[model samples]
Target: MARLYDYFLGGKDNFAADRAAAEKILEVAPELPAAARANRAFLGRAVRHLARNGITQFLDLGTGLPAPGNVHEVAQEVDPGARVVYVDHDPVVLVHARALLEGQGGTGVVHGDLREPEAILRDPGVLEAIDFGRPLGVLLGAVMHHIADSERPGEIVAALREAMAPGSFLVMSHGSSEARPAAVERCTEVYRSAGLPLTPRDRDEIGALFEGFELVDPGLVWLPQWRPDLSDMIDFAAAGPQASLGLCGVGVKR
Candidate 1:
């Protein structure tokens, strides 16, 4: 399988097959790179919010790639002692993360499927890096949709919700069909052809995942609208159909 990092940043780790698939997606939604950067911004802001709110433990699932502004680095900036457990099914990421975090006291990577929460939560690396009794940030950025409805996205989210302590939060950003149906539809078709299911939920369906949690301010807004970095972000936000095509939100466990 091709690693996400290969496709997300134009890296060479991708196979020719993956590159061909990515090209088809870009043909449909040309602003994908921008949307990715916007989603990364949401991850950073949400992590900062959690760290600022005294959450020092994080479980970043489906962490696509070991990019520069990684979740551990972002959280540790707020609290140097913060701990993070990064999970991904990609063997490349698994290998890379292990090497990158070598000798790093508070961080580690594990190979696991998000569908197996029990195993994931019980992994030695995860248990050692995080304390569930304390507030934890469960990050599902740009990944939940990959889990089909038959696999039960709602149930998976609810399980994560139950696992976290009160005051813990769920930070998420998902591709949607709201503002750019054509672009989203095109990309959806492309992914389906490549044997990947892309379910772009509507706002109401997206809200359903937070059924029992209290949504933070500016609830379930678009990518750039969710606590953007600056005024220029709004302008950049307005340019892409994908900006309005994705839903982002943070929900605190009550």
Candidate 2:
């Protein structure tokens, strides 16, 4: 399936069929492009925060297309020896990742599904990139909604929590259903039509994913509001379907 990141970023990696569906989504909710950008920004900020706090190793799950400022780039910028493992099931992402890691020593990308956290934890490449004995950052940026309700996102989170060491942090964001039902409906339809159906939950529902972890300060607010780079969230608020949902946060595994 064509990953939504490729579709959203207007990348040519997506199929013509995917592009048509993406266009329909744009027609339905114009702020989608802005929303995608905001989500990426949130990922950068969260990763930097964790890295600055001494969490050098990272496991970026459900990773989409390797954009310019990716997790490893952001983390390594903080600590030169930072190690990161980018996990995704998309074949195109895997191919690009291998090309990008030609000579990189501490950073690499692996192919895996978030639904199989155990497999990811045991993957030889992932084990090489991360150390379970030390604090790490487990990133699920803008990816949880991809898991169907049948999979129980909370359960999956718990599994991830169990796999990481104490003091590990989970940084995540999801397409929310609150305060923007129409936009959510439109995007949901777009993904569904493409055979990659997604389910956006409300604040309460999304909050459940952090059930076993200790939420960071200012827990669960709008993406722009979560330690905003500037005080200009008004533009984020105006992005209709891509409206600011403060859908990002960090949680410590205890």
Candidate 3:
């Protein structure tokens, strides 16, 4: 799945299988690459926002294949001392992360699943890099939708939220069907046929994941609308409604 996402963003780290799946999705929705780019840009903005707001530690769950403007690269750019722990269940992502992301000071990669937040929280590498008592950022960019509703994604998010400090931030982006239901359903079916089902939620359902946290400015807006810079503004204006297919927001644990 991570490789498929990397392929969507025009990264060269993906294999032929990932490219095949991505091509199938593109057949359904050609705007997917634009949406993927918007989501990646949102991640850069969110991490920069958190780092500027005094978040020195980051717990990036479901960390995908290392691409340009990654969490550590964005956060560390803001503050050189920023600590980051990249978590992912996929061995391929972990291997690539360790080769490219680790060996740098205050950064480490852990093999873990987002569904099991407890184990992730308890991992030695996570504990070494992140201080739970201090304010940190938890990034869940374009990940939760892969988890089925039957798996209780809200509970998974709540568990992570409970572990965060009062001022910690939750930076998340999710795929939604509120604007274009039929198109999104076709996209979902494409993923399902590839053995990776997606559950694109409505705005309310996506907002529910942040139940215990207070939203920052522009609460739960589309990916391009959240604290966009000049470049993002141009992209958003050019992409139009396709940019809204993925919604993103940042919330503080109050």
- What candidate 1 gets wrong by more than 4 Å, as runs, is 1-6, 231-244
lDDT of each: 0.82, 0.81, 0.90
Q: Could you give candidate 1's per-residue lDDT for residues 1-254 as a string of tens digits?
A: 23543475555566778888888888877777676777777899999989999998899999876776789999999999889999999887888788878888678898888888878888897888888888899999888878778888998888788778898899998878786888788888888898987788888988998888899998998888887778427536447534546888999998
Ranking by lDDT: 3, 1, 2
Q: Would you list the clashing residue pairs of candidate 2?
A: 221-246, 222-245, 222-246, 223-246
Best by lDDT: 3
TM-score of each: 0.93, 0.93, 0.97
Leading candidate by TM-score: 3
Over 25-67, each residue of candidate 3 has an lDDT whose tens digit, in order, gives 8887887888888899999999999999999999999889998
lDDT of 3 at 121: 95
**What is the alpha-carbon lDDT for the whole of candidate 3?**
0.90
Residue pairs with backbone atoms closer than 3 Å in model 3 (clashes): none
- Consecutive 10-residue window with the lowest summed lDDT within model 3: 235-244
